[model samples]
Target chain A: MKKNRLGEFQELVLMTVIVLQDDAYGVEIQRDLEERLKKRLSVGAIQTALKRMVEKGFLTSEFGEATQKRGGKRKRIYSATPYAHQVLREMRDLRAQLWDAMPRLGTSQA
Target chain B: MKKNRLGEFQELVLMTVIVLQDDAYGVEIQRDLEERLKKRLSVGAIQTALKRMVEKGFLTSEFGEATQKRGGKRKRIYSATPYAHQVLREMRDLRAQLWDAMPRLGTSQA
Candidate 1:
């Protein structure tokens, strides 16, 4: 399997899409990221990541129902592809393995 | 705290260094990454990541005792700095939060 290369911000955006499930649009993902990470993020940055991931096959986006709340604009909802989940699992396993291999040190507490 | 920006390959190298602990030199880290990741990684790539991370303050290196096995040349062992651990923690927490928020779906199993 080819490795999935994701930058830190891209990974965060991808995870946010998974977390949001059916409600994952650009604005909503940005909001969720800000809330969870406690850091301000530009909508453009999120959009760029979303676009890049979509191109990379880590995420798929489709137009959702046109909502009156946003003047009948149909939001583009993003969802994690199976490839995304696979990469995430790989990342989690790699990190866990490294963490497990760490020697117990008195000075370092994380 | 400033964000520790690591690319996917860089993150893998960084984690591999942490996994190797006291034995984390370029050759050893490359070997461990190959074993765990089941993929051949270039020595140059690993060395570049180690150098970059050391410059970024995510890792520290120290010269270890020379051995006759490899012509008695001192090896520079790399270790994860507290900053690296902190970033790893942040990444873990973020991923966990996103994973927790995900709705269970029959189609997706990770």
Candidate 2:
């Protein structure tokens, strides 16, 4: 498998997990992504991305404490793995390098 | 087609084209990616990505001046389309926002 490569949606979902920190979970992630992107997202789409990232070792999830408000249902909290953070940093650096290399006209035209 | 979404390899190739500016072409891009990434790349792989991005409208290509070194073969120079630049900026901003929201410890562990 190709390692350290993230699809756009996977990157977005992984970043959201990091943003939400301890509260990162399915419902919350979907809501937050919708709010931040100003676009509607299906729960299934979010779950698919979450599952794929988990398999890629970019994320880890653990069930939260059971809540009485939800009739003993536990939300699975997600967190970014070290690998995910490393990839994100490397990606940012690569883009910065490219941007720095761009000629004045290249950016101006864009 | 998903708009404004770039795969990891596609993103790398697009960035390389921007870095090379007017000089961007298949051979130069492949060489640059290999050097920066410290990984060997096949011409076929690079061509495939270039073709894909061109079809996606993230890139545009034009034939450069025929060179004596190439025996009259014109190198097809690649450039980032405005859409590509826009997508790159959006991706950067999204990542920055997520990184900002991360707790200090989140980055520390990574």
The chain B TM-scores of all candidates, as shown, are 0.86, 0.86
Find the 10 residues in a row with the least total lDDT in model 2 chain B.
B101-110
Model 1 per-residue lDDT tens digits across residues A6-107: 887898888889888888999999998999989898989999999989988998889999987847788999988888888887877877887787765665
Return the clash pairs for model 1, or none.
none
DockQ, all candidates in order: 0.65, 0.61
Docking quality band of candidate 2, CAPRI definitions: medium
lDDT of 2 by residue, A1-110 (tens): 56656887888888889888888999999999998888999999999999999988999999998777846579999999888888888877877777777666635555
Q: Which stretches of candidate 1 lie over 4 Å from their true place?
A: A1-3, A70-72, A106-110, B1-3, B70-72, B106-110
How far in Å is the alpha carbon of B94 misplaced in model 2?
1.6
- The global C-alpha lDDT for each of the candidates, from Candidate 1 onward, is 0.85, 0.85
Candidate 2 structure quality by residue, lDDT tens digits, B54-95? 988999899989888746688999988888888888877877
